[model samples]
Target: MKKIIQNFGTIVLIFLSSFLFSQNTNSSFEIKNSSFLLNGKPFTIYSGEMHYPRVPQEYWKHRLQMMKAMGLNTVATYVFWNYHEESPGKWNFSGEKDLKKFIKTAQEVGLYVIIRPGPYVCAEWEFGGYPWWLQKNKNLEIRTDNKAFLDECEKYITQLTKQIVPLQIDHGGPIIMVQAENEFGSYVEQRKEISLEQHRKYSYKIKDMLLKHGITVPLFTSDSSFYFVGGSIKGALPTANGENNVDVLKKSVDEYHGGKGPYMVAEYYPGWLDHWAEPFVKVSTEDVVKQSEIYIKNGVSFNYYMIHGGTNFAFTSGANYDKNSDIQPDLTSYDYDAPISEAGWATPKYNALRNIFQKLNNNQLPEVSKPVKVISIPEFKITKTASLFDVIEGKKSIVNNQPVTFEDLNIGSGYILYRRIFEKDEKGKLEIKGLRDYATIYINKDFVGELNRINKKYDLDIEIKKGDQLDILVENMGRINYGSEINHNLKGIISPVKINESEISRNWQMFPLPFDEFLKHNFKTKNIPENVPVIQEAEFILDETGDTFLDTRNFGKGIVFINGKNLGRYWKVGPQQTLFVPGVWLKKGKNVIQIFEQLNSNETVKTIDHPILDQLNK
Candidate 1:
């Protein structure tokens, strides 16, 4: 009789799952009695977050496979708008930007997919993943009820959905759930520029847009428990973002879900993101294990916010602002101190969680894959160096009657030089009205001083002759990725120059130094002056191709390029000192290295096996 009853129970469970899975036509996912029913069976989703744009194309398969071996059934990713469409109407989905290939890879890896398609993904990315061109639309208000902003979002979603809708489970692919605009609750609460009604309209409008764009999968909104009021959709599931005391999490979702179940922590943060000067964030593995136990015991579904955080690479990093000081630019290496290291090595946390998850899965999890090879390159010497002034001899500059912004000139990333010949001999506190970030001030090609927006320093006392040239070389540190500050982020010298109380508002020669173009220009190699920008080049040989970190501790501030591909920013200022160089991007024989040093020189650079992401300013 006991045997018969046991068999009957198994059959009943299967029946329940099949019943729920078929009930919803739009989505096979359903909520029933505090459980997620998939194809008539209770399903617990164990997921991880990793961005495709963050990891190199060659490593996507490895990373997704690692996720499955670590006991994850699903992988969640955010489709960054700016990453796919850098400029207006310019769309790129091939190669690394191929969203379809990434999703297909996850499916091939035997894992489910949860896509967070954000017009605003706020992953500490430049301008919260909104393209720099969006700022050009003067009247467009982001994250609110604005026609221009919504119009662009609509067009973007339409373009993006073409990649997603084809891969949904109903269409015989792996994608199971889709997220509406990311964490709108936090934004609505923090932004005072928009009204509660306007914010509410904006949030729902995004959900509507997602539906309009043909995303047929289950839609959900993610925010902390306290933010459910502003972040949730009417018929869609509401999932919490950070910790919510299990009881609160279940209660919040139940209230919003018509007293249903299938409670999910959509973004369970295991570790934290490290900014440029901040301490390396390391969450205890033991604590994470404990939380996993609670979720399993309570019959909850959860996804690690970032099971793996790859490199930010290039100018993709973003800045954070506060009411007190200036912006805090994020580090290029987004290690996130996760279970899997940025270099794709299995960490202690990975082993610890694997043990727990294996037990939960009835010991069905696979063994963790071997890590990618990491090689240490011997120090390589510099081959050539060129002066910035000499390199820009023939480059044209916009002769503006008044100082303009990066967006006005369609210059996205890199540096901008604003030159002005002093009309007459004058000396006062020199100030740039809207210095976007950092500036290196020079008097007649002589380095005089430096100003940094991060320090909130704008003015410097200076004396100039009538014929003396005043040059302000400014770098667009990065744009704000979060909160109300995102609305005001504009690069370069945004406004007029000021001398104490007097304003200098005429005859500014603005030069856009897009480093991408510099590689094509013939640099007149010569002796460079001290404390000014210089382009340095070198060649290094490798017997085998593999992953490595280029140590930049010896160098000051600049960008690194290996074989003409950018490895991203490196500053002596602490937190991140090494940039990851993917093995796939290197040739076994010879590789060219380029460095645009805005500060001092380093005779040679060493490619080390380990990354130094915790170093502070020396």
Candidate 2:
């Protein structure tokens, strides 16, 4: 009889353990009494926004651990569509673009996930995160109820939901909320002719689309508090974005929700983004702590816009344009002066926030991870060189009467060269009506002058001899990621190349130098030309691998490729002088370094242990 009782007790214990495990994993998150309820209990979401594509895949866990250590219970990330679908019909989600792995990692680190999969994520990304191929369909208007655009968005969101649905909290995953559209309310003023009711209709369409595609989790819209009416949908919850203005934010939420409860700050800007020419933007630790305390005391949920702003690798950085059409391109490094630095190092801001959260939550914080080691490489000589002209000769040429933008050419990013022959000797005022960003004019293989869009310098005095080969190289610095001008950000010379206000209609041979294809060219080492853009190659030996910065202070504006991986662009124009080279991209022993210098070439580059991020050229 005693043996029978012992066996029954063992069985009961096993059953109870299994039941508790299942309950913990299958916890439901929902809205209850105007507050976020996790498993029927009120929960405060302390989230920090971070981009998975920006950080290396190997460091995802480290960054998430850092966020947890800083007292954040949740992570908010934006899914950049351009990063996933570079070209139409081509989808890549492996390596750095792996959103699934990122979410799973977050769950492992004990954090809930919030995804902002904006078919148009305006996180200062190129084309505002819209794939370049979308522009090919000239009739399809984006960010609206246009059938063509909606169809494409539907396909993308459908594919995305397939990956995310299984990971939602209801399905035993960590994802709690999925944002519908990003900051669409602030843009309503841009569409002056469109009524406020029309804006709400579009917002509703997106929310309905999310539901139709099997997104069971709650949908939310994030917008500035001032523009809540235009940005929010009827069914989806609305959240405000701001800093320290708790009263204004609370009032806005009450006005929208009709005095209901649970207030949330979707994007609390702890640090501001930096542009190429602008001063480095930083927020004091005291201010961040003050704002955070106010939110905590008021029982408000908030997420830092960028708790860790990583590198804008490749040509992914975006530009900004004002009402007057003034251009301000963002720097390569996204180090937004946040708690975590660009290379994932902790700063004073991190400590202050950690202290605040620990005191408020009364929970012991995790030990901070040790800083990653940085190594320095002695200067090495670049023995091999090839000119841009020689490289263009071997590429397939496209003939067009009038030049088209990069999208029309089926080229996504990098530089495009337009070559035309001047039949007769003439000196006239040459004007490129729609120069996208930057252009260099060459007459008879000689550098004549330069034109820039930032200062609106498009007119140039030129002298052309008979049969003089005219070459105008235009570099797509980056597309505007925000504001009203994003609708028409077509890179390259959009209009005809004009001389004396007359359109030059001649057979033009165009060469597309998209960086991915440009790197595959078999560059010649012997008899390289001078005074033009040249490709420089060097090999360095490393005893071990760690995160390091490639100092491009001596070199002119150009892109760096380490072992065929594009580290991103560097200019002498200040702000970002060094490019972060991840240890994963580096291997011990011999590693290849290639640079495509547009202006001046450097024989040697320093692989310094530290990054020179804020040093701007005077």
Candidate 3:
């Protein structure tokens, strides 16, 4: 009798273990009748969009929790190809670029994940997230069915799939949906030459490729409501992006989906992006609340385009061209005036959003996370400086008959110096025809003047003497991110620099000053004369470390680096006066700050606790 009782008890234990295992692992997500069904029930994806690369890895969990606290059950992210694969066949996914870790963290925070792995993500990113080497092919047409482009796209997608396929909902992970190529419909219209049929073929090709590579989750295409037809794929779900216009959005989706049912707004813009020399873009909290309420009432799922717009650190920011062919480079700080600011502080938008979402769900929202402390340090003095000329020695120099663009010289992002020696004295209007962006003229290592493309100022008054050297240091600023202009955004001197309508075609020396190379080399510890571009370094000791802003009021225009990590750029041009310096990059003992100033060579900078993000110069 004892043996039988023991055997029955063992059988009961085995049954219970199997039941729990199934309960923990079993998950079902599908799109039926237009509505998303999770665990065989309707689910509304109140989602927020944030990029892992934009936000620091240390703060990923914090951002995800904030999204959850705001009643967001889902998070949407774009996987940038160039960001992951900088070189051909070379990939880096560790650190902040870790996509798998990002998704896993979202799951840990109880937020579903929607992945938009774009071979091309036009997030105001340099080259639309395309690697600089793609232009090296010379004939590879991107965003199309070009064999070479598609071949490369397939390899990237396949490699990316291997990382996140296991994280799908069916595999007990949080990823619920995958997006087809981002907003291709908008691109189709932007480039009037591309036919609608071609766009459709390209869209389907990408979708088919994703499925071919073990992506079993539902696929969706997000496009502006006006361009839905151009971007939507036949087999994938179609979604729209807009602000507050639910009626038009519903009609557009219904028309595309054959009135079947489920509706979603993939990217609801709460705030707009800011460009250099432009006013900060913002939207009222009342409007956001009203629009969100409308969507919730209509059973519509929506995601904020940027719930937290982090910094566009380094040379990652791109530019846009207006109708008049004017270049507008995006500001480095991507603070988008979002609910969560650039420094991760919550705003009135956050409170309003939390209130609306909480009431809609009839559940008590989680308490907001405590704000991170910001510290203000005394003005640090720059003790060392290295002029541009001093650092150019022994650097790779390319000799050409005429000037070449950044791509032509096989360089990605940075300033390029073009040097030409004149045989005799020549004085006239030095016209740098087809100047891509900003140029600083120097005669025999002396500052002459500056020319900018925005004002169409390509001519500089010059007086060159015999045996004198003319050096034009041209900064790429940034490449045009959108429109047809992107195809021809060749940085540096595009055409020959002429003198009084005469093309000055002569032997030229080109020096590529990519920031990575600039930081790797050691600089001489000596002060250089002001007004010329130079690298400045300063060190400060901190008793305690916290987030702070480096004031650039005294400085002109330059990039800042803290402890070898790039904070971002700051300019005297107003709008963004301070760069956010996270305490994680700071040490308690001593911290190093480096600046590559383009104009003013101020050795001192103030460190403040609060950021001056929106103060515009009159």
Candidate achieving the largest lDDT: 1
Error of 3 at 178 (Å): 0.9
Cα lDDT computed for each candidate against the true fold:
0.84, 0.83, 0.83
Q: TM-scores across all candidates?
A: 0.94, 0.94, 0.94
Q: Name the better of 1 and 2 by lDDT.
A: 1
- The TM-score measured for candidate 3 stands at 0.94
Residue-level lDDT of model 1, residues 25-137, one tens digit each, is 44465556667666557889999999999899999999988997788889999888988886788899999899999988887677789999878889988899898888888
Clashes of each: 12, 2, 1
Instruction: Supply candidate 1's per-residue lDDT for 229.
Output: 78
| Pairs that clash in candidate 2 | 574-617, 575-616
What is the C-alpha local distance difference test score of candidate 1? 0.84
Q: Compose the digit string of candidate 2's lDDT tens values, residues 132-235.
A: 77878888988877889888888888878878988898988889999998998888877867888777767777788889988988888899988887887766
Candidate 3 residue pairs in clash (backbone atoms < 3 Å): 34-262
